[model samples]
Target: MMSSFMRKSLGQFLATLMVIAALAVTSMPARADALDDARAAGLVGERADGYVALVDSNAPANVKNLVKDINDKRRVAYQKIAAEKGVPVEQIGAITAEKIIREILQPGMYYMDATGAWKTK
Candidate 1:
């Protein structure tokens, strides 16, 4: 029931919103814990080597594709986490790195940095 002008205006507004969303996604930061940092953070450190070995063990094509797919999914997941945490998207990498360390890293492994520290939960 809308007029043509109204529909055109609405379409333009939606296009603008899409452009803005794309820009936001592309401009977001790219820093995240490599698996090592997660271990250092006391998360899953014990299993780090084993995980890597599994990845290196001539994984099937589907497994490799799944890994790539998961890595892409992690970006969106971390973006939501950043928004929820009230941190800039650019800083989400560091925050998530710490989270991985705390949540995933295992104990009794050496993951020291030059600063020689870990934030224990």
Candidate 2:
């Protein structure tokens, strides 16, 4: 028969092993072509998250630099627009970024074009 202390230690070790296995399973990557499969299944949240992950993981140095440049330009543009429209710069940034992301993710045109590209409704 095992000592009481040894039994408790063994139980704790097994519990820890189970918790580690659970965590590993939860964080495992999806199967290959998982993004395509998710899109086919109409899993928008999964697809978007997967796409964002892919872009973040595989983006080149130059593209990452370009995105930073674009964001800097956007900050300047937001400040100018906010000043002209008498709106708070933070509010302008929030609303404009939302609208731009929405338009790109789900296309449509509004009165003011963020990209200056005339998009038809």
Using lDDT, give the best candidate's number.
1
The parts of candidate 2 lying over 4 Å away from their true place are 1-58, 106-121
Stretches of model 1 off by over 4 angstroms after superposition: 1-58, 83-86, 107-121
TM value for model 1: 0.34
RMSD of 2: 21.9
Q: What is the Cα-based lDDT of residue 77 in candidate 2?
A: 57
Q: Judged by lDDT against the true structure, how good is candidate 1?
A: 0.41
lDDT of 1 by residue, 1-121 (tens): 9998998656544433433344245433432233344324333221211111122336455445444443455456546654654545545444344444455455544333325342233
Scored against the true structure, residue 32 in model 2 reaches a CA lDDT of 22
Q: What is the lDDT of candidate 2?
A: 0.39
lDDT of 2 by residue, 1-121 (tens): 9998998656544433433343234332543244323323323111211111113335455444443443454455555555655556565554543433454333222222344333323
Model 2 is weakest, by summed lDDT over 10 consecutive residues, at: 44-53
